[model samples]
Target: MVLLGCLVEAMHANYHGSYSSIQNRSSSIRVAHCMTGTPRTLYKEEVYTAYRHQVLDVLPGDLFVVLEHINKTEMIHGTRVRADNAIRYKSALKYLSPRIVEWISIGDSLGSIETRSGYAKWKRCFDHIQRTERINGMKYDFIVRTRPDLYFAKALPKPSKLPKDKILINPYYECVNDIPSGYDRKWAKNLDLCDLTNYGVSDLFAIVPRALAYPYMCVAYITDLPLAICGERAHQAECAIKATLHKANVTYEFWPFVVKIKHVS
Candidate 1:
């Protein structure tokens, strides 16, 4: 949902500890972070340090990252990215120790705005997160699907304070909290209060429950089918997410947390 300006790169990971020993079994709410996307100026301390203070300080969990395989440079939407920006993402590893890191060669497939292709890529990310979770023998109460570039405007709500059955997403349309104002206006068109009545769901971020994680993240699987949400409309990113949830009969609510795509580079 975010049109990023910075070049995307894989994290230069430095694993210092095993997650098995780090996670506290007695923690009331266990969260899993699935990070996909290039955050602007990731190497800066101001970015990751804020994440540590605002997000991890409230909800600590294992981090899963899927980055595009980029070389020295990449040009997207006529924007040229140099080698200096490539190395910036590496600095993020020092702050957030990731659990599983994977890379893929996206080439030029994502040069334009195509909903199906976008969701298909997300499908792979979801697969990686779920696959590693099973192999690691870890189960989380909620899975947070977000981007490394997201600027958390508010601390994540404690698990006890959120609804257990609904998908949590950034406020959109006419939902509660009036949908914060700092985010990109393009993403604003999709929130629609995370409902199907108007726009669709906000694709920028989603807090999926373990029960509906597959249906929520694996939306590429159901993008073609006639959805009950809009009934045979054009394939859209928000529509695809909302339709899949409708099929699963799962509802979504605004998380009340504000996040904007951080553009530092």
Candidate 2:
């Protein structure tokens, strides 16, 4: 186990090629975007078109895109926005024909309806992933939960490590012990002191196959952190946690790509 972990460690350092190099690449491509719409409306294709053009024009490859749908409360014009997300997924796949887009739906019945309620629903999505993993005959290989309103202003990047068996998530976002309330640090630290080699996990994005994501989500869900906290914190916490897990013998990595976009409509 130790030998295998050592191999993953050596490979991670070499893969990043120094922190500055990764940061330079990240600055060049920002991926997440926020889009606004009525409950039952289909997202505009033009927006997606423009986003794809901007990001893909810079980098191109197989991309794993995770879209999360929130709030199943409103029944709009006989249609649920949660359902609309699946439709949007279809539109995205068709609109962005050239790029490989894999979509996953994580929905909740809580949110804006009430802050506490919303958090509860978010937790459900995480619980679902964990339960799904125990099924005897399941199909999904990867599972992700993200905000429904989020849009991709840029093209999503291909995960650096193999996606099937490794856990990958944005290393820049994770839970930490102590720091300024709003300070942003792009480096990975604090989590550098653990041994987790029995599992293959990566920083930030937690890029893993269906098998690993299931368990990872279970942990996140059971812990009860706010969605926004999870998302924003991953930017820094992910790096630290991923590195710590890696050092502990967890086989994981930090994937480089544009993962954020503007929230403006």
- Which residue window of length 10 is worst by lDDT in model 2? 12-21
The prediction achieving the highest TM-score against the true structure is 1
All candidates: TM-score: 0.72, 0.35
Residue 23's lDDT in candidate 2: 15
- Residue 135 in model 1: shift from native, Å? 3.0
lDDT by residue for model 2 (34-113), tens: 11122122245644555456434433322223233534554789865444455545675455442112222344222222
Candidate 2: residue 238 lDDT (0-100): 32
